[model samples]
Target chain A: MDVYLPIAEVSVNAPLLLALGALVGFISGLFGIGGGFLMAPVLVFLGIPPAVAVASQANHVVASSTSSVLTYSKAGSVDYRMGGIMALGGAVGALFGVELFRLLRLLGQADLVVAVSYLLLLGSIGALTLKESLTTILARRRGEPARREPTRRPLWLYGLPFRVRFPRSGLYISAIPPLLLGVFAGILSAIMGVGGGFILVPAMVYILRMRAAVVVGTSLFQILITTAVTTVLQAGRNQTVDIVLSTLLMVGGVLGAQYGAKASARFRADEMRAALGLLILLVGLQMGLSLFLRPDDPFALAPGGAG
Target chain B: MMVPPGPPPMDPPALVAPAPEPPGPVVVTQTPTISAALTNSEIEVDSSYAGASLVLYGAVFNPGDDPVDVVLVVRGPERPVRLVRKVRVAGLWLNSRPVVFEGAPAFYVMASTRPLSEIAGFGVLRRMGVGLDHIQIDAPDEARTVNLYGVRDVVISRLGEDYLEWRRAVIRLKERDGLYRADPSGVRFVDPGLFRAEIVLPPEAPTGEYRTEVWLFQNGQAISVRRNTIQVRRVGVERWLHNFAFFQPWLYGLVSVLLAGFTGWAASRWFRRT
Candidate 1:
């Protein structure tokens, strides 16, 4: 069944919508990334108004992260102290990001901001991830052992107060890394309408040098808090949270995520990264092409931008 | 004096008896004479009715000897509301006196009562059918007439054994320079899952047979109403192209699928590690 939005006066195909949610969910589950980067572009391509699409993507992240967090907590992988500090910093960043978005919109530059941001971020991330994966694969093929280096905790972070010991990650790192990561995630989350899982996973593994086992759980915890706040903010301020659309997507995504997770375990880590990198590149190219192509006419009464 | 009176009375009585013999055999003759003839009246109308503009026309007929008055009535349901009303006749509004009324949803004609002798030459009383009812009045006597026109609120009455069933459908109308334009707008229920209703019209639709199918659904069971004709005609090239492009569903679906597949594939590849 299709549910219509009275305010937007738009009709969405429920099953197709759910499938989209599932695809995003699977990517998030497999890569330990919040699938927001993919969600915004897909929503626009599907003819959803850009503002509504971004807002709705943030809403979906709330659901996706909440579910993932529950699983992580059950496994005792979450760093509560670290997550708390990060969340506090993230809330501040989110508010600032939203204000910036509003300012850009007022200047009649929302579309330009969205397009530029997506192109720059996705292009850089895609190129970097592809390079790393290819280099790792080529190195492995040469039968040379991969180099492992211990990350040195910065002196300033250690000198700062609130030193936390995470037994699972086997580290006594300062709360500064998690805090900064949270703020960065929040800013990106607000702009991109994602839970910031994609950025968070890499930051934890490479920058913070957290154990692989703890990275997924820690990122999910941060995502849960950040996305929950984003959802409420979007609801209270913009009133863009659509319960019906979100529910339909969640129903499909939850099931699809389970299946994708099972399938992902069979693939090697490098293979998954390479696949994800290619996917991001393709989506970025499509978005770029849309700028030059004539857009399809939206058939609904009272389309966006009137307000 | 008595003898003179009796002579006079006798002379008068004799004359009176001769006169009273017969009241001139009362002649009751039945003549086969044409008292009145039913003359065919012509209905005339304008090119188009745009948003409550008055559609002007007249009914011309000759009533022999007897004076007759005509009453105009149109019938349709209150639902899917449309109202047509009468107004002043075109060109002769100042000189002619006419009756006006609220238009109805069905086919109706203008009639008037006047002596045939009074109707010298062509007696044309301009009539008006005005409203959103979209009732096209055919003026048979106009310089250019529309043979087939789009009709609104067409009630399809089903003749059942016990009770009558009625369903309302909009008729697509087109007309060209006094000719009938074939209508291709026919209703269809394309998607069963979504219960999406569509009206399909073809580009090459001519002044011929155009069937409409309205599927009635109750309790998830669909009953088909088939072979409903909506007359189409030549309204010119512009109208033909307009009708043709209205029902291109395949084009939309094709584009949607292609874009979706490409994006989905790209995203998967981009995010994947070697």
Candidate 2:
């Protein structure tokens, strides 16, 4: 059935939106990552304006983060102190990112900057995850102990300023690394139109040396606040958040993630990482194609200071 | 502040000469006067609205033996649209030129008994602002705003024929969306003096006042012109959302945040039991 999206000011196939939401939700649950990057591009492909697509996808992240945080918190897995400190740094970084975004827009290169950065970030993360998972699987097959996660602190991260203890993750480390990590991810979030959980989770585990179980909840907690801030700013300042569109997607997304969580346990670890690697590669390739390939129509339209 | 700039700009009685600007359709001076009305003057959109169509019926009166062609144009609200063109620079496609089309109609549909070009010559149509090719638009100063502050208005004057591509791109995008159409034979004469045309409005039609005009032509010159207006607006929840998004954006943003958070919590609660 066809329905009109109020904020988008466009009519779209209702079932198509629901199906996309469900699919993204399922994938996110299986991979334990917020799927804003995946969903936003698809929405833009389906004729939602890019600005609207990005804004609305952030709202969807808020919902998914909320659900995951609830579950993780109940299981006593979240590191609230770490998430809070990161959020403080994230807020400042996001401000700077927004300013940079405006400056880029004035230069007529904002879209290119966002697309290229997203491709690089996703491509590197995908390659790293695939390599690590493959190494772990090969070690298991070799009848050797799977390489243990880093128990010893890296020298630079240990010696940073603003040291603090996180009881939940059972760590006594300098707060500067996590805060700086949050700042970096926050800048990525603003430019790339994501909640930055994908980048944040890996940083927490490998860089800050946090426990993997606590990372999920902590990331969700951070994502919830960042995505909320994004929603408010996009709506208030940019006026691009389409509630009707997000509402439709969320209806399907919440349920799909639940089922996807149930389905994830049935899959093997190496196979799952391989699937995720493929998906990220696909998204990256799709974005990269527009940069390299000659477009069917070179002329595109944006709503701005028109004559 | 008290002294006037010049006497050349001032004109007497020209402003009030157009018959006191009626809120409804105004008629031009002629016996072959054309009048038209849309099937639905106000399209009320709700949550279930997909798209709609409007039937325009009107009559053109002429005592002479010559046949008079009637063309009806239903133009949606006008707004600004930015146009960007990609160019291959150093082995990669990069957006190079940026242009803006101010006062571009959100939607436009035209129907006539015969092709518009056949009914009138290019000069007449251009002056009357009828056909797509002859339509004129005003260029704004900020559209030429460059990242470099020094180069400003110089770019607009330099953007001569290059600007036409942007205009064409605008039309092409609108046509692809089914928002703009110039049908040659969309209108039909049921009999003498009576004509009708159908206009298809896509679901993406923006809510605003639309200008509906009927032009009567004789020997390729507009003899009589009539103008009317219709409205498109959202109702129910759609209306509420539209109002809130435009007026109280901050509150709407907060609502979105709360709703998203709530949905997440609710979904977890629902699924944990299963």
Candidate 3:
């Protein structure tokens, strides 16, 4: 039952690992989020070193997104041109994010940064999603149409230079906005050790106002590349990725995703959003509580510690 | 410490009686000789490698009809250790300060027939550097160790006033991870003047050279000491990957990405075909 993870240099229960992967993958399929945010924290809670957990989870993200991207491509939902431009910006942002990650680690404040960021991102995102879902549900009961505001581009974003046309999204917006959005997501992807799909999907849908059909697939395509970049960088620079751990997780993730995708149609969209919001809220609360609780033993040894 | 009624030690002519400590006098007469050997001198870690139990056996050469005690210390490689002290800041436990410890061992385990205090005096243990309390932490020469009581900024609690507390915290962390252990009654005698102890290494133990030392004591004073070294390393695929990760990290990273991508692609195709 015990298997040695080479990079982690630790023995872990194989079955337990498979189960954890399945759970994360199921959520990934159900919600269409990259699941990196969920996987990293859970792995840390399960006693994997933070660095290893981040690196290995990045690898798993690449795998899951790869499969999903292929399906999206077949469905003619992917916007390759937009995905490529964002990827270019994302690459630059990821490089900067890696350096920032290294700096925080050197300051011996990496854990603090991770915990605080998780709390802020999860708390705000969860609250917003819950609020939106509730409003939509209540509006439907009263036989009212969903509120639609006149699409007004922010003046600052509109005036930015280097305007480009995205035919699929039917927008001739300035390239700066999409590129900047990609950069923000990429930076978050590296710092959070996730694929950034949760942030990306929203940014594409609302900020750029892309078609809903294009949003999920284009975002998945971008995640596949960004996380692929993350995996290589973490492994090459930090040497924290555990191949065995990632592989085991990927196995269960694929199967769980299959079942999750099949069951997605069974639930209403609002109900699914509410469930995801609740899940995120609970995870955020736990992380918030940890920040206020004193650890029993604070001394730690790291082989590649703040060197 | 008991001697069964059996034939006396073969070398009776050299049987020297225990004597009082003297100032630079002939302490050789009361010196108790000891020897030790580990069951395994090399540990190979493979895919199925979980953990290993190592046995170290030794005997007090000059029994001399006197009851003697043995203490065994097995220590792993030395590494720099860091400890963080969390302080409640605005109702949140923030990592307010950090303590850096130099020359902390990666793994440490000690066992003796009886409690170390009963076997040897504090000075003796201190001289031998066997007990946990007696560990020598190399403090920086410039900084005279400081304590934490809300200094102007985040305080770095180095080795000085709060040294003991920091050291205890280190031990607690190691024990929680199953890396450090102190078993007072772990060692036992297989026969009169002969003793053996088990040094258990968890599967997560760092691969490095480990030192096992045995200290011989008579009349509650150390007489002699012997040491042995064991090597732990990875073998097979684990070894290959470990070497690749450290030596050619960029290539390893590329390979990891490619392999994961391939698996994902293949699995997707397979599931679709089904």
Candidate 4:
């Protein structure tokens, strides 16, 4: 049976959908990572049409980010000006990403492209996060003080035209870093139907060297704007937005985010990173296994066929 | 703000007489020939007398200045049934018209123009299933009369799984006007023992050799009933391939992997410099 969501107009199961949202919400809240990676695959496994799954997951990211960002903001951990500049860049990147997607579809190379990309991306990000968090945990057990050193800021950020001071992040960096991050995140958001938070969070923490407290907030703010724009664009151009599905997912997701945020407060930073790493690894492995598995049936009956 | 006023004048109408012109040569153009083509011109129906509804479809085209009226006639064992007659405007038109008629055993369709215009068309005649007729039952010698539609306290047994089992209540009649109208809603229980099933004879019902078994019950008791046979002629292709491309799950997975990969690659390169 098909069930409709209150807002997204997409049809999916009520119970299963809510469960997925809750699970993802818990993870997102626990870890600074946006749960788009886990949500999109799970949705597809649940028999949602792929396009709908991607688009709806992107929508869910916006909602999830909104809740988390609120918490981070209250903690005085967001760099609004930096985040805004990045978001602007991301919006532009998203436009180009969509065009590239169309061109690939026209060439019938969409499948190969998507498969290879997922295998590499999820594999690398998952590995990196897992390795970093494990090292941090091992160091604490050995009673070694965690190393903290300040490096000179990148010259590119300083030389860029828009130089802005982010008091909270305590950094006076050019807008180039945020803008580039935004553009890349926007492209990824359009193509994968993710909020690009998974990508943004890491970039903010490591590349921009923003404090961990501010990184999550800045990433969420950018994700909310970019993904929301993507949702509208996908709806207007392709008429693929299923409000019913998105609403159902969000209903469960919003509540989940609250619980997730609360639960996240109790966990140490390394624990959150480790969990995210494992989740990403699992998704990556699943994608790889599918390539070798023989499909159930190569052909099936279609509409307008002879009775 | 200030307001301004303007004035205008109107002229009166005039009447004048005009002279008639001399007759000129008359040019007559032949009426454009309207025609239609049948993609599949012929159709066949089998066992029309059985309890089944049959339908015939065809495409009609008009190529003339005026519209063409087309009529369909079916001749069966009992009488002729006029299926339909409709006007076709001058242009290309495809018709999948539906024809419904009552009680007929084997019928053929004929088409013609009301004003005798040239037209062509082709399509198939499909034999849909039979129509159900009214069912009636009489009370047993020991039980009180029970009416199902309006009578309360009537105990009706559960129907069997097979659709044909209910055929016991079907009442077949001789084909008349090459049509039979079945009333599926008229089935009801009058009492416990004696039961009747009604069925409308379709023009394409089988010629002979058929068997059907119907059950009878009262107050949770099974009554006596047996099977019978009637012949039927089947038509049309049995199987065909159905094409469904968009629902393929693998396609989705493949696309997802590629997109994720591209973003990941770009992200790694992007983060390295910083």
- How many clashing residue pairs appear in each of the predictions shown? 42, 2, 0, 66
Among these predicted structures, which one has the highest DockQ? 2
Q: Where does candidate 1 stray beyond 4 Å?
A: A153-162, A288-305, B1-274
**Model 4 chain B: ten consecutive residues of lowest lDDT:** B237-246
- Give fnat for candidates 1, 2 and onward, in order: 0.00, 0.79, 0.61, 0.00
lDDT of 1: 0.47
Residue A159 lDDT in candidate 2:
76
lDDT of 3 by residue, B1-274 (tens): 2443334223312223322224353343334577677889899988777888989997766635577788888898887676776667898777634556667787888899899999977976776678777655554644444432222232334546767777788778878888888899888999977888998999878888998878776667666667789999899999998899878888888898888788778867887898
Off by over 4 Å in 4: A1-11, A159-161, A292-307, B1-274
Query: Residue by residue across B71-110, what tens digits does model 1's lDDT show?
Result: 2212221122111111223321111111111121222212
lDDT of 3 by residue, A1-307 (tens): 9888888878888999899888887787777777888888888887788888888888888787777777677878788878877877777777787777766654457778778878887787777778877887888889998678458756765688888888887777788777776787677677787777777776776677787777877887777788788878887777888999999888877666656655776988877887887777777777777788776655544324323
The TM-score each candidate achieves on chain A is 0.88, 0.92, 0.92, 0.89
DockQ of 4: 0.01
Q: Write one digit per residue (lDDT tens) for candidate 2, span B2-65.
A: 2332222111232122223333564432334566777888888888887778888887756555
Error of model 2, residue B219, in angstroms: 1.0
Q: Mind giving the per-residue lDDT tens digits that candidate 4 earns over A78-130?
A: 78887888889877877777666544433333433455556677778888988
lDDT of residue A4 for candidate 2: 83
- DockQ each: 0.01, 0.47, 0.44, 0.01
Ten-residue region with minimum lDDT total, candidate 4 chain A: A298-307
- How far out, in Å, is residue A247 in model 2? 1.6
Instruction: Candidate 3: list runs displaced more than 4 Å.
Output: A149-156, A298-303, B1-31, B144-157
